[model samples]
Target: MELTCFKAYDIRGELGTELNTDIAYRIGRAFATFLKPKKVVVGWDVRETSPELKDAFAQGVLDFGADVIDLGLCGTEEVYFGTKFLNADGGCMVTASHNPINYNGMKMVRDEAKPISRDTGLADIRKMAETETYSEKAATPGTLTQLDNRAAYVEHLMGYIEFETLKPMKIVVNAGNGAAGPSLDAIEAALKEKGAPIEFIKINHEPDGTFPNGIPNPLLHEQQPVTGKAVKEYGADLGVAWDGDFDRCFLWDEDANFIEGYYIVGLLAEAFLVKQPGAKIVYDPRLTWNTQEIVEANGGEAIQSVSGHAFIKEKMRAEDAVYGGEMSAHHYFKDFAYADSGMIPWLLVVDLLSRKQTTLKTLVEQRMAMYPSPGEINSKVADADEAMARVYDAYKGDAIAEDRVDGLSLEFADWRFNLRKSNTEPVIRLNVETRGDKDLMDEKTQDLLALIRQ
Candidate 1:
């Protein structure tokens, strides 16, 4: 067993190599033993190898005399929904998220959609796998029941937005041939039923295990071109895309301009606060100023957290936060069991546009101009710590203030920069932003890159 597969948030590795039935069985057994829950729910994506892995994993769970509910061919978010809907003790999702076709992994959640992080049980699972603690088989195998909730999931999301209050808008939706197509199909009809003025131009709506259109990761620059082209080709008001498992979502405004997830965080915070004033809004530490301003302006409390869904969800539950957003495109909601929902954010935002009678660009343009961002820049360096240390040393004393919440964050009077090492990759992610000072942000970004290169 490769202990490295146990990541900060979930277990992931190359499919046939580091991840296989043997590994899956161990993980299942570990999960069942550790959770010791009465019933465990299981879900998987459309990946070709997901079925076999799911079966093997469930078998491990049953060996421990824990019943398993198999939620077939669903997105990871659905697994979250199932955990809460069925009142299960815990759940595991068989997915590698946006990883390449040759990779797969598992994401586990505690009862009521709580996350299982390294601090919780991920490390124990790794240790159990390594130690080969095979428990004695029970007298009877736990039963497995196939279940479907995609329709109910869609219906639940619809309850958040008012279709009769929406205006007809042209929007381009790029599923990237992931698992979002079915959900989007349901949403479109639901919107039409309420007489919404909305038209969807969809691309790569078909789910294909081969990922012929490319991996469903919308973060990569190469993947943006497809959605960007669609936005321009159709002359649409906006474009929305999702990752492989549809856990995170991305947006593009009119004229094919990519909207920063940070800005959307503030926008959604403000929108959600209008209905739930005094509610706490959760945001990652990487992008703080804008989210703080938005929440404070709306009379809502702002809670800063480290990046990743597990950390955000845990904080959201603790703070009883009404909403949470990460610069990485993950958004969480209180209504959805405090779990992140890739579907609801877009739906609510679109509904906001309709209720306000504005375009998506119009809704976000002012905020974008107020806080120009350098966008997240990924640098592949020999040593991430060395690169981050060099960058930090250069700016530490010079900056007005510094923070080590998630990584190294330096705040100047009018600008700021965050340099953090990736949890899963040998790289450093650098994000710089300025208070309406694009030239200064650009110049400082280059200077930091030069320092890292040195």
Candidate 2:
């Protein structure tokens, strides 16, 4: 039994062929056997298969004598929150995130919401699941309990921003028909109770597993325009969109411009630094100039971590970072058990808008101008290594410095680019940035794309 569903960081597979209730049960049993957890937290997204899978996984835990605390119908971060909040020994979230409609997956974590990446304990879980070897069952099975922590979680989120500072604003929130709808509704109710004077114009805000609209991934250039158009039509102060599981969030400006996640990183770094000066900020290596400058200029320390949620969380714990952000829209906070949250970023951004008396565009425009980037570009190729080799060979002579922290990063005086092969696909991603030269950035992006696709 080779578990083809196990990936580098989590579990993901298509229906019937790779994953089903049986495999999910085995995984739950294996998870319990490996961790010997006294209690486990479980949650699932809006995927049609997710409820059955969650029940199967929870049964495995119960059979192994570990109690289950089920937080029904929630996002991935909610499991992270529940694990730490309930003092559970481990947690699992049944969610495929931004994957296709036919796909489903699970993300696991240990006590205190620590991630279970391949290096930590995922490999051992996979092996145990494949072998189907389990410890003896207890005489009496563990009990199952249902808990709704939405109110507590919303309070925790609201703690990140001051209600008094929030001004009158109209915003568009597109849930893309995923699990975020219910949670967003809870937050909206909380805001109204406090008289926050914020108007939310919702779109595709139902939890439909069929995804009546396309999959809820705003990272796709084509999917972004829907939210952007809504922002313009509503005359919104800003717009926010989330993926299926709502772990990563994308933003749009007042004029309906899609703001790249790179610029948001800089904006957020400055926000944190303003309150807690001299704090450490962890950032991914894909786009560096803007984040580096902002962190340094604001009297904060900037640290670079290899891309990925597990790696970023590990680095944040080691460095005791105040915040960590990836160019792909993942933002982590220290107070949130070092877990990434799609909900926190927007709240904090809106709070900043009210406090600074500025718009999202104004806050990020100067930084965007200072460090121009075309965002991340992915190219599918026959050989990822060969494509990278060709790009490196073409620019090695003129490169002043090179860093291979997560991938290949070449830096010159005015511009730099990072090229890395995708972990889960036969594609290579390229990110290029220049110092205040959009034309140069565009030219280099085109040059690199030609080389990568050739």
Candidate 3:
């Protein structure tokens, strides 16, 4: 009973063959058996199979004598929030999060919302699930209860910004028919109650598991234009789009330009520094120049961490950092139990706009020019390890500095690039950046691609 659904960070699998109610129940029982949690929080997304899966998982927990608090339909962050807010022993979210419509999965976290990765607890859970050995059922099974923590979650988001300072603005929000619709509605309702003059023009606002408008992943180049076009048509001050689970968010500017997450990391570093100078900010090593410069100039310390939510969260807690961001649109905050949130990033950006009295383009354009990057490019390879080795061998001669913190990162005087194998797929990911030289960035990007693909 090897579980193909278990991945590095979470659980994901194709329906029927790899994952069904039985496997889900086994995982639930295993999770309870390993942690021996007294109480657990559970939630699901918009996928049609998610409700049944959640029910099955909850029953397994109940049979193991662990109480279940079911949050009907919500994003992944809500479970992270509920775990800490309710003081539950653990939490689980049933969602595939940007995977195809035929897929579904789950994410689990322990007390205080600590992530459960393969290194931490997932491997043990998988082994226990496979063995099918558990303690006898409790004499009286644990109770089941329903809870709606949206209002409290929305209030927690509001605490990140000062609503009184918010100015009149129009924004475009595209939920892409995922679980984000309901959560965004709660935020909008809170904003309206506060008499904020922000206007939200919604698109694909319903939660449809069919994904009528394609997957909600705005990270794809093709998936970006829809949000950008809406920004221009609505004359919006900013544009935002979210994936199925709404853990990562993508942004668009006033000119309908898709702003890369690298620049947003720099912008956010500066924003947080303004409020709390000398704060520690954790960033990924893939893109360093922009975030490094901004953090240093703002009287703050910049620390580098390997890319991934679990690694970043662990580092933030270790250093007690103020904020952490990755180039993949995942942003973590110290106050949110070191969990990433899609809603909080945009709200903080809006606050920055109001406080700085500037547009989104004005804030990030200079930084983009200062450190030009083409964003991350992925190429499918027959062997990801061999491709990375080939790229490194070709460039190691002229490289002044080399790092393997997460993957291969080689730096030269004028430009640098990081090439790493994808943890979830058979692809090589490349990120190249130059010092204020777009042509060099372009030329090097092509050269690297040629070698990587050859």
Each candidate: what lDDT?
A: 0.87, 0.94, 0.93
Stretch of 10 with least lDDT, candidate 1: 129-138
Instruction: Report the Cα lDDT for candidate 3.
Output: 0.93
Q: Model 3: what TM-score?
A: 0.99
| Model 1 C-alpha lDDT per residue in residues 1-454, reported as the tens digit of each score | 4556788889888877788888888888888878887899999887889889999989999998989999887788899999998999999999988998899989999899899989988888788776777566678879999987777787789888877777767889988888888878888987777677789998999988899988899888888889989999999988999998898899998889888899889989988998889999999988688889889999999988988888888889889898999988888998898888888888888878878888888888888777788778888889988888778777788788888889889999999988888887888888888888889888988988888767
Candidate order by lDDT, highest to lowest? Answer: 2, 3, 1
Supply candidate 1's per-residue lDDT for 127. 82
The regions of model 1 sitting more than 4 angstroms off are none
Summed backbone clashes in each candidate are 2, 0, 0
Kindly report which residue stretches of model 2 are placed more than 4 angstroms away from their true locations once superposed. none
Measured on C-alpha atoms, candidate 2 has an lDDT of 0.94
If both were scored by TM-score, which would come out higher, candidate 1 or candidate 3?
Answer: 3
Clashing pairs in 1: 168-197, 169-197
**Pairs that collide, model 3:** none
